[model samples]
Target: MNSNRLPLFTRADNFVKDLTLTSNQLLLIVCAYIALILNLPFLFKSANAITGLDDFNWLFLITFPIFLFSITLLIQSLFAVKWLIKPILIITVIISTLMFYATLTYGIVFDYGMVQNTVESDSAELLSYLNLYAVVFFIVFAVIPAVLICSIKISYQPFLKELFNRITLFAGATLITVLIGTIFYSNYASVGRNNKDLIDYITPYKGIDSIYKFARKHYFYPPLKFQLLDTSPQIINKNNNKHVTVFVLGETARAQNFSLNGYNRLTNRYTANQDVISFTNISSCGTATAVSVPCMFSRLNKSNYDKRLATSQQNVIDIVHLAGTDVLWISNNNGSCKGVCTRVNTQQIATTKSNPLCDGEYCYDEALLQPLREKLHKLEYDNTLIVLHMIGSHGPTYFKRYPSNKILFTPDCQRSDIQNCTQEQLVNSYDNSIAYTDYVLNQIIIELSRLSETEDVASSMLYVSDHGESLGEKGMYLHGLPYAFAPQEQTHVPMIFWASAQVSNSTPDIDLTCLKNKSTNVFSHDMVFDAVLSITSVKSKTHHIKNDPFYGCKSASFVPLPLLESAKKIQTQSSGEH
Candidate 1:
């Protein structure tokens, strides 16, 4: 060989020899690559959604991948034992798959609230979310990488040398990550504050961190104890007239889709024909059943409401029961009343087998009706409060909420995987659920009317949903987004009020005309506690006059409602409901 050629050949041989890696080193590299592949899509989507790929966002896109890579390397190095690699990788794959599936399917950012909901959700509810598409996606993205990692041949090195290399790699990666983070400190902080969901959108790291935080907040933290607002609430009986109030607590019903609220769809057909008063602008306390149910029943307003505090004390049910009225909570929804019904007479329709309307696990909202009628028949109290918590339009299983004969809209999405359906089909399926709810409400009203006629009972029925739902709007589906960032579709709920002639005549000061005018007025979950107390004639110091929708019904001040002025303005733009 020529002298120059020999030197080039020698250098080439040295380069090839240097490329060889020990099993630990190779595993670290594989983990790092997998992490990047799993996280990059999320990072890109989150950055675009937040900052729209502007200069500041570009900086994030460039640095975030590096940060993720370095963190994965550091983690792999710290757990560098030959036996630990497969287990860690497998766990990573599983979690990563779940995170991807949720983010893509529902457009949800896995924040602390999401983590809390996940932990609190039952097996059935969780299983309802699973489908073939999500499984396929998980296999393709997560399982494929894991399989590759497991199949690779690993060359062993001396334990001491491997340990030294692992420590050195971790230290180097940590130093680099810290340096990058420090340099972009201000930019990161600004983006994080402005777009809080960005942090939540980051894959396995965010998911794990949120779960840890949720656990700490719920389990490790000290229990919050608060005084019940109306410990000695009392109902003042006027004329000794028998009063019966049926409070229907609905699930995922939005005002925008209700014909009573000026929507084009005749979703509220039954309620429209009746003398029901529908509120056009009503916002929910929270975007999920878990939070909204407790909040609605609590004296606390949105500004002051704390989940811990809400759970600790007696709510509307306790106060109502204390006021010498028989209170009963009948629920078709799987979720409990979040401790609100702990002291009240509660019946769960989902648990009963004798009711043909129920199938043990899932049931139509009408399933609550039969149980409610039975309870009503046995009621011995002159003044009674019956709460019917309905499972109305809960999705992406909207088709299942209503029976086959009740599906008013054609081309309804039958699949649980809503993404597989067209936008029109999805809307049709959801609207059909709403129509069925209308039918259920009409049946309840008819039952109430029958009781009022047959017995000496003065009756009324009030219906309000726990929270509204998002139906494929801007790539968002379902509810439970954090309240601060949730769109109107997730918060603007429907409310209906109907009173029999006897009950109306007894409370003659509650002007029906004034209430009809105030139907277009803005209100929120904060009004519910006081409104219920006012309607039931439960006098308590805890009830705020300003929060009561009927407080100024007979006064000139009723025209320009105070609550409407103070409440959040409703967004004019509308979206499809679930």
Candidate 2:
């Protein structure tokens, strides 16, 4: 800042040299800075939570220089006439926007998973971009430069000279600001108490695409080596021995919400009436359908799933197809993202179904089962593995999952946003969908039973959800909260099996009766591989028959599967064992 010598100390020189500021402008600048500081937490918290939680410190730690430099530039404009103000303001806007954009890009690269975790799992990118835009607008437009304009100091020089001076001021100010920030940060930092742990927890070790590829390759969570079970049930009394097994893969069905799993409503009455066995304490490896479906099907464990060193080998479905058992994937999901059924045949028309509860909309779970009867009629095979992916209990549109006629409980939640509704209404809508899913499963079983009567075939049905959903508990809506932070509602899913009397009694050597009375101690979506392989008699290298962690671990602890127990342990430890 330079002062020009006044011409003989006249009144005109006084007007030129003396800097003046209105009270309102000063107040506005102070208010803007205060608002920026206050709003910084919410803005940076989400980004940092995604990239690394330590980001909150930068708000106070380094913000001073950014504020000072912007204000310095702003104050310099005071010497310019009203004619030059518009150009100066435009330049300031451009520079601030570019800086904010750069900061957000850096934040996102380190913390994409947090973005993935915060956004609704379906529309993550949109949420991330929107969040960045909001943060940038506040800092650039309302915060920094506003403070500078409030101070009544001004100067004017050639454009090049001004640019050089501005650069010098920015460099000096930034260096000093950072040094002060380091001191402030050191004062506030604490061992394991600050954002350090949060930063580590959310930081992505690998790119998201790499993570996806890794998940698809490993397919198993906490992957253990291929250990085939030692025992196999002998089919000695072989009368009408042709066998047919159906594996129904349900979508987003939480076991806790299922009436069969002890919810108040009769959500699964149809299966309860039949010779169905419900395994209540089952958990999915991952929460998202994309991650969980293929992961459950893969031989790779969860820890090693994303590890570059993990082996890439044949999945359970591939083994089934190789064993000459007809394998069919009938899905309502968007093909599981990885296209786990890419090599295998899949039937999915549910995408086109209109919502029965609303006009011109697709909602009924039964829409997936529409073509099943026709497909089965065409098949001539004696042994078959039909995987039905049910669109069960996916929300915030829980009310649209089932038909209006199927709303068995009174005072139904007509709206999709269950968070705003009464808990009872939410339960009623959710349970009604489960009731409809139960009906669909029962109908498929009845068809299998009819086939068993007419043809020389053994029939059975096994149902497992990819993962569970969460209702409005602890201020969370829908599902797909980060698995570590996720409630039991999202992880604990329902697994059930229906076997005909002939097959049940003949295979009485494998006692499911104990499983019926007590929820199986060894239960997981991982066990689906062993269960299906066991059911189809595909005693191959990929199958596990005995000492299986699939269910019924001979341990004192009531926990069904060791994987679930371990995940719970990991989560507990990370949360300081709270």
Candidate 3:
């Protein structure tokens, strides 16, 4: 190998053979390549976010790129070993290309929560995110560069010389970072503190950081034993009639889109006259199903919600099962339950290809109803709690969520790359999905009502979404941004409840009028644990009256809207805010 250029054979052996590069040169090239090409989304976002002005400005032009490049250079210098740099750079580029596509298209960040979601997602979910556009993007951005990188055969310096060069390079990079940072302290401080997610936008590095964080927590950390929260919970309002409660866990259905929450369209037409109380102002624990589903079921509130901690401890499902209520989880949303249903009986309908409503890829929410009816007919326990996890409006393929005949909205986007579609088309598809979810929920309500009348069971139902989604609002798409800086479109979700005449309006029996009066009042997933316990009549030590929203809305008396807002304001102002 010549010092200026060397011919090293590649597996394919197609590219220019002679590559004149040293390990130090390769390191600099890799760092520069990632900082400039792979970090375009991050750089562009930072540029826009930093500049309050409409046009491109000078301060941001000078400050961010140099600082970010210096940081990348320093990080790359740490791994500048002769044999290690190529593979490392190749891997970084490949993974970051996908991340870059996601961030540029949907404004997603590879935060810890997103990493967890990615690792937990099933094949169907994974395939949904892939398309021709994504393939082309990856090929242009990742594969070609990786192939070129693989072809590079570098010259090496003497061991002592290499070590000294690396030390000097590292020191120089560090000094450059410090100097630029000091020069742009005000600009950096303003953006960094106000936009904590600015750090998350750093491509490949943030993705790498998230992967390490998730792995360390899941694999390397000390595992905690499965906690049994309440083996013997207090069952209230025991009566001759059986207690049947259906908790429908919704997926990605936001409150603002539902007609029940004053959407201009009748997206919630099916449930409009079903005598259900829609909770208008409801916040989710997290912006993704992986976090929200488990967190809602767990004893932890959103403020203290940790996936590992929440999963290790027994959730509401476990408590419900222990209270002698036969617990059944009917899942149409694969991977959305996030192990919350592992302790209980579960039936998968996500890929029930035999079902007419379902293809091999996914099933409609109606797939849950038949099994539920069968379970109702063959009821073994008087007190039963059934969780129907619906794949409601989950995107970027919302068009596939419902059957063709159920498509109430026209001009719906049929493609997976929703960014290519008009806002109207995208929303039409999403609205149809939401409407279909409501139709399914209405079916459940009707079935439960019939059971209450014919089989003499005290029945009720609650449908609450795991999280909301952004429909191109403020140049964002989908959910699973970091919760700290996530928009309301990804955090505020829909929650609704319905009770049959069999459920008397009294203590332990929630009053509809009272619940309606507090419909506009604020609530969060923090209240779901105790609310579920209360609804299922499973009263454990953790099921406090303060945490059960229904328990407070037992009276049929109505509070004025002004008073409700004032109360909400007070509640939000003080401690223990959601």
Candidate 4:
């Protein structure tokens, strides 16, 4: 009996000794551990908060181990080759570092949009997001572990045995995960649908999924080509009064804070003094410029608009240009015009020679004025459209949007890291930027008024922001929240119209009073394309009169009045005051 027990003990000891992990297997194990640790925030915070208190503990107990085990199996299966282990470790380090930095600095969920932004961002934009804290954190958490992984010596199992073991482990993990998911389908689905951001909070997997989706959408997908709204748009110049329309595209300006929109603050003090018509309710096509700018200029409405189609097709500007109208796009903002100005003349103020308003990188919104005046002077067409893209209230450097003298709001937040500032300071700084935008728009209106008088051109100005912003509201700072889940602060923007006396006199069909009365009426970026087309008198097959705000103001037969009653009323009111 003693001899039999001794042989059994020896056999158990030999079995324990033989249970060693190869270098690739050890790397997989380390990666799995890191993935679990990185995703602990999602498991403990986002997921737990969404689950009911009664089910929270059970959910965690059931899902946590499964999540870790599943991740391990997935990674091991993908990186099964012995030589691929080092490359996998390096890739993991980079992804983990980025995830950590974004989670720590911006508190952003790593969704597909965020991933798209990451992939599309230039080196400068990417560098701006990095800092000392992020570097240190990456070194401590990601790089050090990666180095350790590379340094450790590993034992290699026989090829067949290793392959069989990997297949068995992966199969077991997948079967268990599917079984658990089936058993708790109700709870899992409820939490997943209710809290879609839960998936975004999961590390490595979140990044992996986002990259996969982005790649599939951008690379694997075939490029979609869309036909122009009109193959040949016709320009019918009514009265030929040298019509000139200035479209001021604003950035990060929310309607809620605009004094002209009934905000308590004096953010629109300058614009308020002018004869500008401000719209109270205007929703953006998207919550980010990458989506909004293209959507705003496309013939398709937000619901029907596809980014690929929008980017590929000729927009309002292009169609108007094709109709024999001179079009110019002047941009003070560093962001691209999102192909809206691709076919038209473009003037980038930041790259303009000896521009004082620019520091060779970022420029004030006022920088656009000089180039605009130059372009207006050189215009030889009977009708023209000039777009001024302003860098208004762009953050997290809100204080930089305006000049020092224009910082009307005191105790403004000066730090680029806006999260470090108090809420009051953030508001003050952001308000100052809005005030400067007011000043810039006022200056443009003054320029248009001067141009109308000097050049005998009927000038008008229309302002609409690409998207609104989130100023530390609900723990979210900056914009780019998914449109489906974005707050009102990121979708509701400001739109204003200012017509010169000459324009009003020449185009009588547009009733300013009726337009003013319609200020509180709901509008959106969808109106932009049709409104611009109507304003320029460019007739196209794609033009929808219902989408144009001024279409109803015209008389029967859709003809504009040669003289404006609104212009006469203004003159009468001015004369009475005098």
How do all models score by TM-score? 0.86, 0.63, 0.91, 0.86
- Tell me, by lDDT, which candidate is best: 3
lDDT score at residue 490, model 1, on the 0-100 scale: 93
Candidate 3 TM-score, C-alpha based:
0.91
Query: How far is 20's C-alpha from truth in model 2 (Å)?
Result: 19
**Model 2, range 67-89, lDDT digits (tens) per residue?**
43344434433433434543444
Worst 10 residues of 4 by lDDT: 569-578
Task: Predict model 2's lDDT versus the native.
Answer: 0.56
What Cα-based lDDT does every candidate model obtain?
Answer: 0.77, 0.56, 0.83, 0.75
Q: lDDT score of model 3?
A: 0.83
For 1-578, candidate 4 gives per-residue lDDT tens digits of 46456787676555545556576467556756666666555666554554554455565556755655576666656675777776777677677666765665555666776676556544544555455666677888778667656655557678888778778767776786777777777666777777766666777777788789888878988876555546777776557778888999999999999999889999988989897899988999988777888889986678777667677667889989999999999887666787789888898775443776765567888888788888788878988999999878877778878889888888998776677789999999999999999999999999888888897888888999988888877777778777777889989999999887765556434567777888888889989987898777776766666567877654333433432343244224323322
Which pairs, if any, clash in model 1? Answer: none
List the candidates ranked by TM-score, beginning with the highest: 3, 1, 4, 2
TM-score-wise, the better of 2 and 3 is 3
Question: What total of clashing residue pairs does each candidate reach?
Answer: 0, 24, 2, 1
